[model samples]
Target: MSKVGIIGAGLSGLTLALALHQQSIPSIIYESRPDAPLNIGGAVMLSPNALRVLDRLGVYERIRTRGYTFTKVDYRNAVTDTVTEMQEFGGKDKYGYDALRIYRSELIDVLLEMLEAAGVSIKYGRKFAKVLEETERQVTWEFTDGSRETAQLLVGADGIHSTVRKYLYPDLVPKFTGLAGITAAVPTAQLQAPVDLHLPLTYVLPGKGGFVIAPQQVDGSEQLIGKQRRVEKDLTREEWAAFMADKESQVKFLQDIDPAFPEVVHRAVSNIPHDKINVWPFYVVPRLNAWSSEDQHRRVVILGDAAHAIPPSAGQGINQAFEDVYMLSLLLSDTAKENNKDYLAASLKWWQESRQARVDQVLELNKQIDLRRLPQSQDSDGLEKLNFEVGWLYDIDLDQVVGNWLKEFQ
Candidate 1:
């Protein structure tokens, strides 16, 4: 059987490993972090687009048990305390699946368990440092620990700062979107539960200088979720705190909004400090001229964030990476069967051509979202414009979206 080496054990890498394992394809995953669980952030809104992939991976039900489902979304402007837009998610439960608000850790645990049950091996602390292609038949990877291994193909699922991407496209770098967002999970007991916490999975209140409020149920318990307004790039902790400290300015703007909404916002601004929030510096890499290397002798590929990094505005980052795993597996299963080296090289080329265009479109949409959320005047018209654009983003379907993307590869 042909061997595959995947860099990064994140959502993308692990999902790819599981999909490959389903075909009885063997692969090893190398993660740079210590062999321990790290708390990266609080919760995430998993739309049905991503849920479909989890279903195929056989862990959807497990995740659902630990998450909360809701059927509607509300968008409001904090400055004037006006309701900007409210949309029904077409009633997800009516369609047999509902959108979910889940703790990030719970989602990771589910993915990790599914991978292990399939006997997939993941080596932590094995940082990807370099890739060296030997003779036409094999490729070797150099790790931070001075260890090396060769395989028929190398997959760079390493995330935003992918070492594989650096080795392949050294000149390209992830450009910060000048937008910094902060997120944290506080206990449900802290907030007065929504009148119908069980009905709506999330509530987003957009604020000036780039802020949003999302209420999610992580473990069937309500949690007050808050995110800072989007900025141009990453912010220092001090800068984030300073923005939150502008109490008079924020209160003057938000005091009249629905009592429940501002109560949550006021508590968020007053209670949570920058140190307590998980702030991700938003960045993206536009589609490149080519996502694969030349020469039939060596076969190395990039998947997920390593190839295309999208901001969280669209919530498609994980789902798109899952799409990458699914399509790549389909191509490789047909060509790399029985360890056929010649077929492996041809398969990767097809994978690249098939996935690049679609990935680029997703990236573009995220950029559009980031741009639309910039600080706007405290007027209903401006907020209305923002809502029109934000609605377009949350309403995308991953399976159909990516299916058209892979049509060419077929």
Candidate 2:
């Protein structure tokens, strides 16, 4: 009961473990996979907010140069090819770190390496079945293998289909957002793009949607060319998995481009290797009344996608997960000495409310981006195009935020 038990060894869970270790809090990671976190996410774009967390946890330096780095995402007119709007992903001059597009595996490797050096243990192939019980001081859980374990705290960083989340919301399911990102990586040269062409560009055709061509890799040798699809009828989790596994169908989806789409898009999807494609269905977890149980014990908790899975509109899906891990660690460390249930409960309340505000902001940002990308978004109703001044998202001070909350409540 001296450490935390973390479910899911994915980015969020591993990062949480390291964040706890940095506070001298020992923990174990239980991953359902037989090996390292399933590296299926392809490459992820990390903005400054998430990078700051990694840098603080000693993960940035290891990966800063391993992937492509850029600062802006250009939304271009499909016909004129002129830029219509831009989203500031990150800026070394403004945010102290440029956005990074690194493979998920590379980042996970660094986290696992750090934890191993720190002597943290990871129980691979140990699937989390469900939370068995929660006491005032500790929580216990069972693995699919019938094994059980207890810890001072139990965290479900176990992603959108989280088994751990079932303990908190027995009937809750991740609602499909009617969209899915269909993507594939091809050599940057395949596009034969004009030299002046922006690296991360989205071309919008009013009625259809955006076609994205974004560079990846440290040398910018490859790019991810993708578009979103609307699924009228939501599929079960198993159905979605099967649909994603159908490489031929996924490739066909990407290739089903409008003739009016830019030539670059056509070329980009011309010869996608079946092995390099990814199908990411958008799913969102409804806002929960509590990230922790209503029971006074509140020993079991959830974070990352398990708590709130937002779409990748502002490319904050991973970035926001990083925030959750970092902020929770700060809050826990702030109240470690007292270990007062009242203080812990208050801190968690503050954490959820504050994080919810940020998530809400991201959702709004996604709406603005959606307006530009999707046809259905034409019914904007009242969504405002917030000035691109997103310093509030990328420029986060985790310690200061948690500290101020503590002082106010004290």
309-401 in candidate 1: lDDT tens per residue? 877765677767777788777666664243655455556665676566656665555454444444342222333333323233344454464
Cα-lDDT of candidate 2 = 0.87
Shift of residue 349 alpha carbon in model 2, Å: 0.9
| True lDDT of residue 5, candidate 1 | 92
What lDDT does the true structure give each of the candidates? 0.63, 0.87
Expressed as tens digits, the lDDT of each residue in 1-410 for candidate 2 is 36899999989999999999998888999999998686876999999999998999989999998999999999988877789888899999999999999999888888889999989999899999988878888888899889999998899999998888888889998888788889899998899999999879999987778899999989999999898887887898799789988999888888998888778888898899988989888898998888887564777889999999998878888899999999999878764545566876777788888899999999888888888888566435466665677999999978788778878877
Question: Candidate 1 — which residues are off by over 4 angstroms?
Answer: 37-39, 79-82, 87-96, 193-210, 218-220, 229-261, 268-270, 273-276, 295-298, 336-350, 364-372, 375-410
- Among all candidates shown, the one with the greatest lDDT: 2
Q: Once model 2 is optimally superposed onto the true structure by TM-score, how far is the C-alpha of residue 164 displaced, in angstroms?
A: 1.5
Candidate 2 — worst ten consecutive residues by lDDT sum? 375-384
**TM-score of each predicted structure versus truth:** 0.77, 0.96
Worst 10 residues of 1 by lDDT: 377-386
